[model samples]
Target: MHAIIQSLCSLWQSSWQGMVMGELKYRKGSGGSGPYRVSASGRRIVRVSAVSPSGERMDLMLFPAAGFAVGGRKAEGGVYWHTFSADEVRQYSASVGDHNEIHQTESPIVSGFQIAEAMEGLEGKQDFRIRFHYPVRSGEAVSLRSEGKTVSGMTDVLCFVWEAL
Candidate 1:
């Protein structure tokens, strides 16, 4: 039983798939696992959509569970990178009226950042990292190095951790 249990645990952890597209992606939970179960009423929903300059849309959903902590585990803040495709970014600049060449394709790249109100001194002013689980279309992978003063001296900060596949 011990050998069987250990084997199952190993297989469970090792089974996690890295980010892939145009492939049959498994719908998973906050922690990806399988023999994935579903709710009876199908009341749960997760919506994926584009803000302005629409591109790809992917959605997976599950029922909520206990303990809704605003911030995720720090140890799980793993490898991070993001790139904004020039295509989806076009209509975005038009929407924002930031037609400055500095924000457009001629600049090669643009970046963005945010800090959670929960992450203030109450949570300790700290830096976070990111990995491009999906292709970043706009305002991405930006740190204080790129944007400066992520969460310092703010009334309320809104941070978004996109998602990890």
Candidate 2:
């Protein structure tokens, strides 16, 4: 029974990672022909067009999570890395009213607030959206990196998208 349980747990973990950290795809070009563009303020603008649409937009002014400096520059931009512990997850859950059991398990899923907190003051919250492709497990360090105008991590998984308002 012990062996069987261990095998099952291993299998589950493997499957979970596979699903969550799936292959990530991104564009490698610099420019595009769209109604929107990466603004000078690091935000994106989606102008109304004949075949396009418009809405409240905001930009993601990214910065290093560590607040470090490089080449005399105060780390203008870098990736955001964080590892949420069980206790931290619980505290965040309680504060945000997220009582899902999925967060209380051994893996201790992370909450959106946690990510937002990590990104606080770095992104324009007025017009932004966060997508959770997978719930980060406890002690699993995840890095949110800037990909052009979007922030992605974990197999290029899109963690947050910013637009202009």
Candidate 3:
């Protein structure tokens, strides 16, 4: 995921300077290690897609700078909360070789990958899509709630909305 982000940013003729992940769709079955094929389009909303050796696909939408809105509806009722500590965020960033400075600040924001990793029961799920609505700062608690096909992660404002595809 980090590699893909870097590649896309390079293709955009920019760095991670102002880039943000807007949405991600992953199809998990049949993928092997990639010598993947990737493509990108759009300006305001950069759309990127990757196809792996076995035809597995991942699509991503990105916003350069603050191209997308920041806040969203709060998660309500019967939700599970997870608080990612600064240390955990740092560790995950290091483990993933994503040394983005945003994740290194005193009050850092969790990376999108970390949020997705924290979600439970994703294993063996064939496909899923997640839209990032807001950033989850370090030490902030995120509420996770599942209803039918959707799963949401929220603080006071929604951070991400997820669905099984």
> How far off is residue 44 in model 2, in Å?
33
Model 2 global lDDT (CA atoms, 0 to 1): 0.40
lDDT tens per residue, model 2, 64-128: 21222112211224355766799888776565544445556667756544564455446543334
Candidate 3 positional error at 122, Å: 4.6
Per lDDT, the best of the predicted structures is: 3
Candidates 1 and 2 compared: the better one by TM-score is 2
RMSD value for candidate 1: 17.6
Is candidate 1 or 3 superior in TM-score? 3
lDDT of 2 at 163: 25
Error of 2 at 165 (Å): 6.3
Better of 2 and 3 by lDDT: 3
What TM-score fits each model?
Answer: 0.22, 0.44, 0.77
The residue ranges of model 3 lying beyond 4 angstroms of the native Cα positions read 1-14, 31-34, 41-43, 67-69, 120-124
lDDT (0 to 1) per candidate? 0.26, 0.40, 0.70
